[model samples]
Target: MKPADVIALPFQWGSELRHRKLFHPRGVLMSGRLERTAPEGEGLPLVSGPILGRVSKALGAPGRLPDIGGLAWRMETPEGSGKWDVLLASVMHGPLSRAVLRPILGWTGSEFSTLMPLAHDDELWWLRARITSTIDGGGLALTDIARRASGEGLDVTVEQALKLNEFQPLARLHFDGVVSGEDISFDPVVNEPEHVRLTPQWLTDFRRAAYRRSREGRDAPNRPTPEEAAEAKDS
Candidate 1:
């Protein structure tokens, strides 16, 4: 195995012991629609379709604490040929700062970014989402956001940029309700569009290893906690 795969073993053990995802364990499942708003361009072809999404706080932090926000979703690709999964995290809108994820106290008015560039048609592009609607007063709870979405609809604008800070509208995402009883896990590394590729092969390898280990941990048979396993190993 590669060094990255070996190094990801602990995360697998951790998830198995915790019986949950190592990151973003808690989230709200949402049902939404993505409508293409921009004309065909040199960028990715943003498709219009029904979407299933999850909004979560990284580290599974409580609603009151600042946390890295996550917006992950799955949608159909052109001609219903396949599906594309996208995972974005809260990030700044500047040139250099856009690469860094920032924790936010609430979800509203936050900007989410791909953090890494995607190669489409031999050109690099970045995807982003901006929360355009307001949720009253520290709207951090899952149910609160769900309620608002079901009633007034939570609106977000999806954008794309060839370079940082020069985003153009790509689509409008509207969350109409909370999806219940459906467990969904998004792995963009494996579920991306066929025409597009994530840049930096090393990063993709690392992410693939991590995701594989996480899935193994989640699916493994019940085992002793990491501490207990370590003690047994030491003995």
Candidate 2:
């Protein structure tokens, strides 16, 4: 895996918070756009989803946007029918203690916000990101990454000295199957590290919420989530 070279874009926090704005269609649809991308591209295809228009209509805020941050990757390989992709979106990219991180996969915020495709598998994984701290002088930071493995399971890992981004993704992803993007899932409630496996009820509730969002294709109710949509592309 090559080091990610990403620069932060200007981020807005208040907009998404207004009028429960993030829950509005626009917020969901914008997220959906980031979710849909062409696999043939170099890293993140950055494909926009078909429901963007609906989200836009639902979102009356002409200029307001959501507080989004994280990374996206399109794995290069010869194993699956289509290219495998990974997306990590941070709903709350703030500093919090382990107490806060344990529940929502270490995220200090809410919602189901990550989408990643596996080259050798057929399910989509939702992931979360937490910035550990800033490094001395490399425009980098030590970060802890988390994702669910199942409805009651999750996996956690770390990416040392990753580029910091306040708005856009913190880094670019280019892998040659070294970091397998296959059959990955995350569930904070039941998947926390053994020591912290017993998650709180709130975390479990949030997980269920995210699951519903993914299963419903919140932004495009007419379409299936990426996991179910995979067949349309491969078939």
Candidate 3:
């Protein structure tokens, strides 16, 4: 397995985050939403942009991957609620795309989905750290300091600490948000609790992309090409 793959295995296996509805009859709501609000910015943080771009290029050529520009959302769920700067650009996962809009589009029979954690403070931080690490090796280290300074006092497990240290950039989504349980609601798709807006055109494009991807999957085989087969045989 590739080095990145080997590193990612632990994260994948150790994670328990799963996608769920905005409201679950069996699930108890956490309280309020965690949030982060930043001054308007055009592109991603300068530190992580180039790094993420480099890694994502391996997944697909430009414009083919999922991109999020200036994503500012307020999530009020059972888990922590906060508004943060989400510079999610070129994510290659379908489920993740679905989760962003799961509350509204979920009942529409959309095939996309994502796994979410009941409490995801650490998970989200790590995900963001992994992305930032690409720009600088000190990504997690910097966060460690911030986490402590914030006084949330959440413990970082040994495994999580280790993952933070060993993480490499596989994706790029810069994040900075404060999480707490406050007046949070998930009904509004755009223009809600604060300075966040998701254009209808953008959502439409995303859905179209998902559809194209699905159609491609149904029409093609994922097998390696003849050249790859030859290389494998020789080895």
Report the number of the highest-lDDT candidate.
1
Q: Least lDDT summed over 10 consecutive residues: which range in candidate 2? A: 2-11
What CA RMSD would you report for each candidate?
A: 3.1, 19.2, 19.5
What are the per-residue Cα lDDT tens digits for candidate 1 across 1-235? 9988998888798788768788888888889999999886547876888998888887877655778888888998764788888989999757677679998877788999888888888888899897788877574666667777778988888988885558888999999988877768898889887778777878888888888998889898888766889999999
Candidate 2 is scored at a TM of: 0.23
Q: Give candidate 3 regions above 4 Å deviation.
A: 1-33, 36-87, 90-197, 200-203, 206-221, 228-235
- Best to worst by lDDT, what's the order? 1, 2, 3
TM-score of each model, paired residue for residue:
0.91, 0.23, 0.22
Off by over 4 Å in 1: 224-235
The better candidate by TM-score, 1 or 3, is 1
lDDT of each: 0.83, 0.27, 0.25
Score candidate 2 by lDDT: 0.27
Using alpha carbons, what is the TM-score of model 1?
0.91
Worst lDDT run of 10 residues, candidate 3, spans 50-59
Any runs in candidate 2 off by more than 4 Å, and if so which?
1-67, 71-198, 216-235
Between candidates 1 and 2, the one scoring higher on lDDT is: 1
lDDT over C-alpha atoms for residue 100 of model 1 = 91
Model 1: C-alpha RMSD to truth?
3.1
Q: How high is the lDDT of residue 139 in model 3? A: 20
